[model samples]
Target: MATFFGEVLSVFSRAVEDDEEELEESEEDEDILRELEEKRQVRVHWGPALELIPNTDHRLHCPHLLLTVGHNASRFVSVFFLSRGDWDAVGHVSLWNERTLQSEGSACVLYRHRDSHMLMCQVDCFVAEDQLFQWTEQVLSSLEPSQVTVLSDCPAAEYQSAQPLGTAPRLRSIHTSACSEPTCCPPVELPNLVSGLPAAVMSFCQLQNISAVVYQCYSDVRSADSTAMDTFRPAVEQLAHSLNLDLCPDQDVLRKVISQAAVQSNLYI
Candidate 1:
């Protein structure tokens, strides 16, 4: 009698599982597919200078900070901090070309701007080999809500290769010709390129009339979440809060990433 009852219970469970699977197949929602398509982020290419002008609707919000990812051989990437109400350039930060960074072995550039309510803004950067990946999250987390747009991947092959527009200090980098190995150029040895960085950066803040702070966060984690990365979060969050911006992330998703990283590290070690 006991065996017979157990057999009957197993049969009922199997039947219920099959019915639920069928129900799931039959009730699949089309709206979810539509939302997925609607929520996709579009990539915008800035031909020369990195353009960060936002969509018209976004202008109604606060000021937006625009970022341009400099290519390995691209010239100074232009950054515009635009005022939402008037669409005027409140300030800007110009970045050195990639070749220059490789030779200098760091991310250093000159920044200058005007003075206004937007002065003393905060900027935190995650320098990576490729900017397109996780770019949306980088911009969102680093900038004010609805106040960050990016212009990346310009076509120009080399920075300063083309006669640049003005007396803007030209950025240079080491390059390898097809037939030759890597060649290093004599450093341009500009003042700021040497020791004037803090002053130069501060000049931009002063011109914009706002106090500013810039954070350089290392790209040590490949995934969104890692226990090791958690240490960096507080500082990243603090930087955003200083700029009066909120930081967001899916904690559950991040935790999974961290767990995976731990497992992978254990396996390798």
Candidate 2:
């Protein structure tokens, strides 16, 4: 009986091994039909670094910015807000597309509290070769898509020729870290005033001055229900009023921006 049981266990083990082998073979076969990796290069100059920008650690509150850029599947670059208002230093992550920027990708930027008067900015979900198509959307979601500015390596001539634009986004004129820790401040929660709200909202709220805050919210999915907008309208209106920002609850515009964010962030069905 012992010998018979041993034989049965051996057979079962063999069967499991065979199944795993078959699955591996099937996956390998599928890869054979996939597109080959292409080698390309793209130059992304972040304009020029501003040397006179104010340090971030000393201020009570200041604005921050983040950017995501890439051209190919394996090549990508991202910027962290060392200081917003003027000069910036960015860390580049380029393990895949080391040369060109054509692949699809995404990036997001958020301000995390480091300490009492200091803030740390981070970029995440950056992929190079296999997962480049969604980098832009990911970064945008991180940066709050609705608040993003898609900048390209445009020539000075093209920029001058471009249509009218509002004032440029604020950057830190000079930034300094106080013992590598940001000063802590009160938590500020901005209301979700957009229509067709998404399942989850990711907020990047920055405290500027005691009363004003800069926040960007990314939702997991787009809302199809019309009433969803109503639920968030009052919350958003109250938030703006509380913060003293003179923004009216523009349902139509808010809906369009969120919808565009959903698409650009690749929050698709």
Best by lDDT: 1
| Global lDDT scores for all candidate models | 0.30, 0.27
For candidate 1, write residues 109-144 as lDDT tens digits. 212133222222222222333332333332232233
- Model 1 sits at a Cα RMSD from the real structure of 19.6
Cα lDDT for residue 120, model 1?
Answer: 22
Residues 1-269 of candidate 2: C-alpha lDDT, one tens digit per residue: 24745653323578888999999999987776442342222111111331212222222232222232211100111111222222233322222344333332223223332222122223333234433333322222223221211111111122221332233211111112111222122112223221110111112111111111222222112322222222223223432343343444345544654565466656465
lDDT of 1 at 184: 23
TM-score of each: 0.23, 0.22
